[model samples]
Target: MILAVGNIKGGVGKTTLAVNLTIALAQQGRDILLVDGDEQRTATTFTELRTEQLGQAGYTAVSLHGAAIRTQVMQLSPKYSDIVIDSGGRDTGSLRAALTVAETLLIPVQPRSFDIWAVDQVAELVKEAREINEGLRAFVILNGADAQGRDNEESAEALSEIEGLEFLPVSIGRRKAFPNAAATGRAVTEQTPKDSKAVEELAALLSAIQ
Candidate 1:
């Protein structure tokens, strides 16, 4: 399956989810490809760090932008077990290009007023995307929510009002482990000592998507 972690909303943890989700999926022993569809190349940078620090990152990580991005992904999809796309934090052509080939789109939003408002725009895109790609599914995932606050609940409440996307019950809290894992070129679940909460959260998310 091809999964895309995307949103038009920047600073909402889209790249974070994209990179980590790729790592988590790869840890499942699946042959995964991480495609950096974003011009910023955040996912590509992560894999670079993985190569430098961890030595020989297991899977392929490449940047695929431009109008032909969708065509490229379609051609490459059959060669991997799963292809995960990470697009820029906006409604750019590359993002739209990614949507054309993605099976499911996961929109990760932070638990705040700004983030809550952003989901509406993407839901509209998803609704439109599904018109042409009937098998496409969209899910609203809560990311970086305060570990102890009503903001998470309130955000989920706001997400519930969205028409096209399904609200995912699973969420990833605002944990230092995310940045820490990124710094070390590993998933939070792959961190040394292993953060139990982070592991459990990611596990739930992977299960939800599957």
Candidate 2:
């Protein structure tokens, strides 16, 4: 499967989710390929940090931008069990290109009204993508959610109204473990004294994807 983690809005944790999810999938013994389709090259940097700082290369990572992602991924998908594309945040060439070939797309939104409003463009793009790629499946996940607040619930409720996108039940809350682990190129699950909530949240999201 080719999975692209993206959103129309930036700083909504697209690269973070892509990096962590790729590592988690690799740790599960799947042959995963991490593709940096974003011109920012955030995913490539994370893999580099993992190798340099932690001496652990989570998986094979390649940087391919713009329309290149569409062709390269289609060619490479047959070789790996899964390909995770970190397409940055925007309605760019690569973002549109990814939708052409990706089997699944995961869009993460913060629990805020602005975040909820930003999905309109992405939802439209998904509808267009599905016309050409009938197998394309897209989902929305509420990330950076408040652990014990109603904002997350409210966001999930709003997500239900979006057409052509399914909502993932699990929500990833604001946790220090995410940034702390990313600094050293680690997934929350790989942290020594794991944040139980972070682990739980990631596990649920992973289960839904698999």
Candidate 3:
């Protein structure tokens, strides 16, 4: 499967989710490819850190932008069990190109008004992409959700109203375990002094994807 992690809004944890998903899939023994479609190259940096700290990144990582994202990913798809693309925050060529080839698109949004508003833009993009790629499936996952509030519920409600995107029930809360583990090029599941809740949440999200 080719999955793209993207959203029009920045700071919504797109890279975090993409990187973690890539590493987690690799840990599951799948032949994974991590594509850094964003200009920021955060995913590339994370893979480098993983290579430095663990001597192996566990999966292949590459940087591809613009129309090359679609062409290159299509050519490379046969070599891996799955490809996870970390697209840019805005509606750039890279993001648009990624949508053309990806079978699944995961749009992570924070439980905030701004992030909720950004969904419409993403929906429009997905609508356009679906015209060309009929098999595209877009899902919205709430990230950085508050543990004790109706914000998550409100966000999910708003997402459900969007025609092109499906609202995923899995919510990843504002947990320190995410960044703590990412600092060492690790998934929350592999972090020391384990945060069972974080691991469980991620596992549930992965299960939903499958």
Clashes (backbone N, CA, C under 3 Å), per candidate, total: 0, 0, 0
Q: Of 2 and 3, which scores higher on TM-score?
A: 3
Better candidate by TM-score, 1 or 2: 2
Put down candidate 2 lDDT per residue, 1-210, tens digits, no spaces: 789998978889999999889988999888999999877888888899899987878588999988889899989998998999998776468888899999899999999999999888899989988889888889999999986878988999999789999998888999999999999889999998899999999989988987
- By TM-score, how accurate is candidate 2? 0.97
After best superposition, candidate 2 residue 85: deviation in angstroms?
0.5
lDDT of 1 by residue, 1-210 (tens): 899888998888888888878888888898888888888887888899989988877788889885667888889998999998887776468777777788989889988888788778888777777777888888888998787978889889889889978999899888888899888888887798788888799889988997
Model 3 regions lying over 4 Å from their true place: none
Clashing pairs in 2: none
C-alpha lDDT values of all predictions? 0.84, 0.89, 0.92
Better of 2 and 3 by lDDT: 3
**Model 3 pairs whose backbones collide:** none
Angstrom error of the Cα, residue 51, model 1: value is 0.6
Q: Which candidate leads in TM-score? A: 3
Model 1 stretches astray by more than 4 angstroms: none
